[model samples]
Target: MRITAAVLEQIDTQTVPHRITLEQIELDDPRDDEVLVRVISCGVCGTDRGCLHGVEPYPTPGVLGHEAAGVVEAVGRNVTRVHNGDRVMIGFPFCGRCYRCLRGEQRYCEKNRDLTFSGYRLDGSGGMRRRNGEELAGRFFQQSSWATHTVALEQQLARVPDSIELEMAGPYGCSISTGAGTVLNELRPEPGTSLAVFGAGNVGLAAVMAARLTSVEHIIVIDKVPERLALARELGATHTFHASSDTVEEIKELTRHRLDYAIEATNGANLVADAVAALGMRGTCAVVGGSSPSAKVTLKHADLLGHGKRLIGVMGGGGQTPAFLESLMALQGQGRFPLEKLVRFYDFADVNRAIDDSDAGITIKPILRMPA
Candidate 1:
């Protein structure tokens, strides 16, 4: 089938910049374990921008979206999880046979790197190509949903509740889930504990919202953006701080050097050390940010070993099951999780503009709505 897609012709750089182009592409039919979807909306995540700006590795002439929500169009012979016309949101792909997957840790699947960034399916086959039949990398996260239509593994989808708007469901596939899941599923902070979040971007703000649902006593947010800090306060943060050299000191002072938990969600700002430094004895810090492949962090040895502070990395918020996504949808429906406050919609044709706005911090979460 012919479909319209936003294709990244090449990686962007300081010397030579390239922008994603809208073009007509050919999409392959669903395979035995795949399902075809007509995407209604897709979120522009940090990972997508990382690839666009050459911070991450992804082959050129490829499609890039992963956070997609849409209606099912067709299903392959073996697919029984969903049917045509069913609403769904695409989630991270995992090889079901991996040891981690068997242990219910699909987010850490052995083939996660390949399934997400390899561009081609595990068998080296691709789902999209140029009009002239040139192969393009389109299987990003198994659902390269920047296009109007996408083919993805049936297992990588979660049903969207009827009460939730399709446009608001896409972020649950990645960013939102990453922040919220890190708290709800991984940390599960004890009652009356204090938690600090670094970087009040989409992910950090999501953490603030999730923390609101917990018994966390104090929620402190740190960011250089004043507007984001204010918004974080509105989203349930008990305290907000401007990112500065003394930010960690402020957190230490506020928590009396006994901060119970901290989350680092800065998109490659290298705030791990600060997050760890803000912790108290035996405190745990969850690092859930997207950074360059070569990026590394530095932490004081004593702050870790001496204080017994733990620094853990979380991917896509630990383990994202369909039920978890549904629960979030239910929360949104009940007005408990106001995801709408973070979103701003854009027409699919304005893809570049949406990216620009997100980069400029003019938009919190940008969702591109596909043409009807």
Candidate 2:
């Protein structure tokens, strides 16, 4: 099928910048284990920007949009979970046969790196190509959904409840789930505990909202942007702080050096040390941010070992299941989650402008609405 897609012709950098442009591409038919979807909306995530700016790895001439929601147009012969005409959100892909996957930890699937960044399927086949017969990397997160249509594995989709607007559900596939899941599924903070979130971006604010649903008493948010900090307060943060030299000290003072939990979602601000430093004795810090492949963090040894503080890395919110995504959608329907507050819609043709706004902090979450 011929489809319109925003193709990343090459990586963008200061010396040699490139922009994603809409181009007509050929899409392959669904494979035996895949399903075809006509995407209605897709979220522009920081990870997508990371790839565009050369901070993350993605092959050139590729389509890139993982947080997608749409109706199933067709299904492969073996697909049984969903049928044509069903509304669904594309989730992170995982090889269901991996040991971690069998243990209900699909986020850590053995082939996660390949499934997410390799651009092609594990079998070396891509789902899209140029009009000139050139292959384009299209299997990003197993669903390169920047295009009007996409083919993804059967396991990478979750039904979107009828009560929820499909356009508002795409971010739940990645950023929203990553932040909320880290708290609801992984942290599960005890009653009356204090939690601090670093970086009040989409992910961190999502954490703030999720904490409100929990027994967490104090939710502290830190960010350089005053507007984001104010928005964090509106989203349920009990306290908000400007990112500065004394930010950790302020958290320590507020929590009396007994901060129960902390989450680092700075998207490569390298705030892991500060997040860890803000923790109290035996406190745990969840690092859920994306960074360049070569980016590394250095933490004080005693801050972790001596205080018994734990620094754990969470990928895509620990473990993603269809049920988890549905629960979030249900919450949104009940006005409890309020994901709409963080969203702004854009036309699919303004893909680059949407991305630019997100990069400029002018937009919290940009959902590109595809043409019907």
TM-score of 1: 0.99
lDDT of 2 by residue, 1-372 (tens): 999999999888779876789999999999889999999999999989988898888998899999999999999999999999999999999999999999999999999999999999999999899999999999999999998999999998999988889889999999999999999999999999999999888999999999999999899999999989989999999999999999999999999999999999987887988999999999999988876667778889998889999988898887567778889999999989999999999999999899999989899899999999
User: How accurate locally is residue 172 in candidate 2, as Cα lDDT from 0 to 100?
Assistant: 94
Q: Quote the lDDT for 217 in model 1.
A: 95
RMSD of 2: 1.0
Q: What lDDT does each candidate get?
A: 0.93, 0.93
Worst 10 residues of 1 by lDDT: 318-327
Q: For residues 311-336, what per-residue lDDT tens digits would candidate 1 score against the true structure?
A: 99999998656668888888999999
TM-score for all models, in order of appearance = 0.99, 0.98
Name the TM-score of candidate 2.
0.98
Candidate 1 local lDDT, residue 28: 97
